[model samples]
Target chain A: MAPDQIVFWVFAPVSVGSAVAMLFQRNAIHAALFLIVNFFTLAVFYLVLGAPFLFAVQIIVYAGAIMVLFLFVIMLLGVDREESLVERLRGQRPLAIVLGLGLAAEIFVTARASLGLARGPANFDETVNVGGNAQALSHVLFRDYFLPFEVTSILLIVAAIAAMVLAQRRERTTVEAAGEAEV
Target chain B: MKTPISYFVVLSAVLFAIGSVGVLVRKNALVIFMSVELQLNAVNLALVAFSRLHGNLNGQVLAFFSMVVAAAEVVVGLAIIVNVYRRMHTANVDDASLLRW
Candidate 1:
């Protein structure tokens, strides 16, 4: 097998394994760590897929910012205690397992069926053009996709404000409860 | 020889399924949120794979948008989780059923 295929084989298992580990981990912190591993492996996959810009963003945004946010909440709430695995709703676990398996089978069959089809358009090539991955991505993102890009920025701003508002409300309620208790 | 796109698609599918199972079985809202992130990552992988297959950058661009949305989602989601914890003193989803008739 070629080196690329070998590398893909190795990291594919690593990513999937860590995801499974995240699911079974009782402590929220440990689960977050496992997810970081999964994200890192996925970043490597992005690199192999020839999207260098996506690789960088996957590492920076996902492995760095998002994971830190998850860890912060896990620590702040101290909800790291083990969760009771017992299902509150009857048959939830069994139903989930059955559905997951069915989904997996469906995807596998579809993938196998499509294996014989021709690859994408012949004019398309994987190599970087005169510019690099970042340049090409920026060209498309800033020009053709400008509207969605701007909208994404707006969504982020709204989310930040919402977060601050929610946190402030929590603080206010806590202070009010403490004051009432003192009175 | 080029790696078959089907391999990447299959991997993405499996990861997504694992994430779905985590969402279903995990009780902690934080962990459930992480599972959702996993699912999102799976979708990003499929997007990138198809981008490579088609020799276009659109899929990668969409993946970038997905990541931005995910970051914003995490910020809002974690804040809501923290707020829930503050009010209920627990992260268990079942415990937060204040609207249950």
Candidate 2:
């Protein structure tokens, strides 16, 4: 087997295993840590795929920013207590298990069917050689995808404002209730 | 030797399945949110794999956009969770059922 295949075999299990562990973890902080492990493994996969720019983004965005946000929220809420396993909706767990298994079966069968016809990996080195991953990515992103880029900025702004508004309203209501009690 | 693309695709599918199950079975709103992020990351993996397979940059660009959207989603989702916890003193999704008659 090639070195890439060896790397894939090593990291893929680590990624999937951590993700499964994350789901089963009762403590939110522990779950978040498992997710960070999965994210780092995925970043390694990105590097193997020859997308160095994406590899960097995967680490910085998902692992750095997003995981920190998750950790911060988990800490702020102090919900690190063990989660109750009580079924919120009857039969949901059984149904989810059945569905998950069915989906996995379908995917495996499809993969098996296509395995005979799959072409060997094409040459990605040529693409990566075109002025490097970061340079090539920016050329496409800024030149061809400029509009969507701008739209994303607008969406981020709107989401930030909405979150602030929602959080502030909750605070205002609680303060008002406290003052009314004193009155 | 070259690695076939199907392996990556199958891996992505498995991750996606696990994430879906997590969303269904987990009651904690934060865990459910994390599961959703897992699902998005699975899709990103597939996109990057395809980008490599096709020897093009389009799929990577789409993945980039997806990352931006995921970031924006995190901001709003965490804020909502915080607000819910503040009101109900819990982050259980079932506990926030004010609209249920």
lDDT of 2 by residue, B30-66 (tens): 9999999999999999898878777778899999999
Best by DockQ: 1
For model 2, what is the C-alpha lDDT against the true structure?
0.88
Tens digits of per-residue lDDT, candidate 2, A2-106, equal 888899999999999999999899889999999999999989988888788889999999999999999999889999778788886789899998899899789
TM-score of candidate 1 relative to the true fold: 0.92
lDDT of 2 at A127: 43
- Give the range where candidate 1 chain A is weakest over 10 consecutive residues by summed lDDT: A121-130
DockQ of 1: 0.72
Q: Categorize the docking of model 2.
A: medium
Q: What range of 10 consecutive residues in model 2 chain A has the weakest lDDT sum?
A: A115-124
Question: Per-residue CA lDDT of candidate 1, range B1-101, in tens?
Answer: 25677788899999999999999989999999999999999999999888877778889999999999999999999998988988999999999998999
